[model samples]
Target: MFRLILEEEGYEVHLSKIAFEEVHEVEKLDPDLIILDIKIGRHNEGLLLLQQLRMYRPTMKIPVLICTAAISVIREQEEILQHKGIPVLYKPFDVDELLHIVQQNLLPSETKDC
Candidate 1:
């Protein structure tokens, strides 16, 4: 349902709980946007992958959407992502709000102008 909404909004969304070669492809392709869940498995694995993305050559500066159910670490997460130029999205948020932010951040300046 949520995927359909994002797709309808013209986003080619890819959902994943794993950071593998496919995700590497997303970086290579450089999609207009991305959203990552915080707890892929355990121990805040999202943060680990995020850190790896920062080191990865292609995705280093991509605007990532970090979705987490944890409201406690929002502040800390903000600081980490800010340094790498990645944005975040907290869980239990409206889908529309999520899409709006993703579109706003992911779109190139020229695309936004259009």
Candidate 2:
């Protein structure tokens, strides 16, 4: 759903169903931004992957946008995510809101003007 929406908007989107194994490939992909969910197959895999990415050099700077339905989990990690300069988008959001957040998180040079 997100892939189709983003692709229609002229952005290349990559879907990773299993983020843990693919986390290593993220540096190679070198995407301008990453939209992450809190639960990826497991309860805390996303958070763990986020930490791992942050610890690495090349992938650390990539912008991350958290999109999840786990409101309680997000609230628990809100301070940590804020300190890391990451933004969160609650689930059931409008498509326009997603696009807006995506645009905001992308590098200025990479953003496409609508």
Residue 71 of model 1, lDDT score: 64
TM-score of each: 0.76, 0.90
Query: Alpha carbon lDDT of residue 5, candidate 1?
Result: 73
Q: What is the C-alpha lDDT of each candidate?
A: 0.66, 0.84
Model 2, 1-114: lDDT tens per residue? 888889898987878886757567888787888889988876668988888888989988888999999999999999989898899999888899999989888877874321
Model 1, residue pairs in steric clash: none
Model 1 lDDT, residue 9, Cα? 65
Cα-lDDT of candidate 1: 0.66
